[model samples]
Target: MSGLKKVIIPEMPPLEREMIALRIANMLEEGSYVNLGIGIPTLVSNWIEGRDIILQAEIGMLKSGPLAEEGQEEQDRINASCQFICAMPGSSYFDIETSFAMIRGGRMNVAVLGALQVSAKGDLAGWNNPSRGLGKVGNIGGSMDLAVGARKVIVAMEHFTPGGEPKIMSECSYPLTAKACVDVIVTNYAVIDVTPDGLVLKEAIPGVTAEDIQKMTAAPLKVAADFKEMEL
Candidate 1:
């Protein structure tokens, strides 16, 4: 948070939450076993209806569908966020033990999760937001296991905090969810890869330049050779 100035690019309007989720959904490969965390990640289910991807919920649900319509809600059919969801055909249910086992056992291929902060080295600080209180512990839920156990972790979140602070930092100020666990970050304005070298900028929204993104990012960003406008 040091030496970072608060700034906003009015010319480059950030993508809407739905568009962010849609961009993430398009990146998932076919036949992948994916988990959608709460918040923006939960909206991904709505865009993958006809895809071959299989969605898993930590609460013992498999092949979970999009959020249920107003009149189609089922009390027992809910995602990890506790939002009612539609169950796709051939959906299966299991006990909590089995559900966690699948996660900790490394059965999940990709996990789309929200983040409070991500370090340049790919450290993820998502579980506890310091604003809650000095020592209050936020519900960690299954993020720890998913961060380490999943083959790939993709964080979907806004580029900056509501107060215009950069969420991607040189070092996370909040408690870490996992160290060096993030693979990709899909923010509203850019798509970044957390590589061994550093955070690489792969894509950005039209009209936004590398210097523009650099102004908002606390960590140094390496623009990929093939950088291009995001395909929103």
Candidate 2:
């Protein structure tokens, strides 16, 4: 929507879903208490084995581990995605009320979530896509609380929709999950930081330039001084 002209990017290989999860995992610090939202964010646990980071599930589990192997799933041990997960030693289980109390009380260090659109000012819109006609019926779940309560919020999502529309925009066209709550965005094509100055392009996939990413994003992107190729 800005005057920046769109440029066609040469077809480039994007990061695989696992790689995206790894990239986000690499950004976490030791001793972090993290909440992974459904979708790609749920994969982060698989890459964090042996790390000091602890995973939390809104469905009343803490110290959650990676996804369960085939035929290893237990009916009661699941993450927010409804996928069976392994539980770490000292894992704790409680009711949803206690789980949300931890989230709302701001005890989480980070929350990795999926998003539909993120604005230049770090606004997140993930709960509903109006085009689906779900309207108020769409599930909001714990996204709102996590976005607001986490010390940092990182969005892990694809850079574009199936129709090839950019998910990073000057303003969100969908209903917002929270305002200016996103801190970082890791996509298949690039890693960006949402800052007071603007969106900063941090790391991009090999062969893609900041200019190429800018053409795809609706908002302006400021290239970080340390910009470099994203590595898993």
| lDDT per model vs. reference | 0.90, 0.91
Cα-based TM-score, every candidate: 0.95, 0.94
lDDT of 2: 0.91
Give the Cα error of residue 89 in candidate 1, in Å. Answer: 1.9
Instruction: Summarize candidate 2's per-residue lDDT along 1-232 as a digit string, tens digits.
Output: 2233444554998889889999999999999999999899988877888889988989999898777899999998988888888887889999999998999899999999999999999999999988889877799999999999999999999998766788899999889999999999999999999999999999999999988998888889999999999988
Tens-digit lDDT track for model 1 on 3-61?
Answer: 46788755768899999999999999999999999899988887987889999988999
Give the TM-score (vs. native) of candidate 1: 0.95
Tell me how far the alpha carbon of residue 116 in candidate 2 is from the true structure, in angstroms, after superposition. 0.5
In angstroms, how far off is 92's CA in candidate 2? 0.7
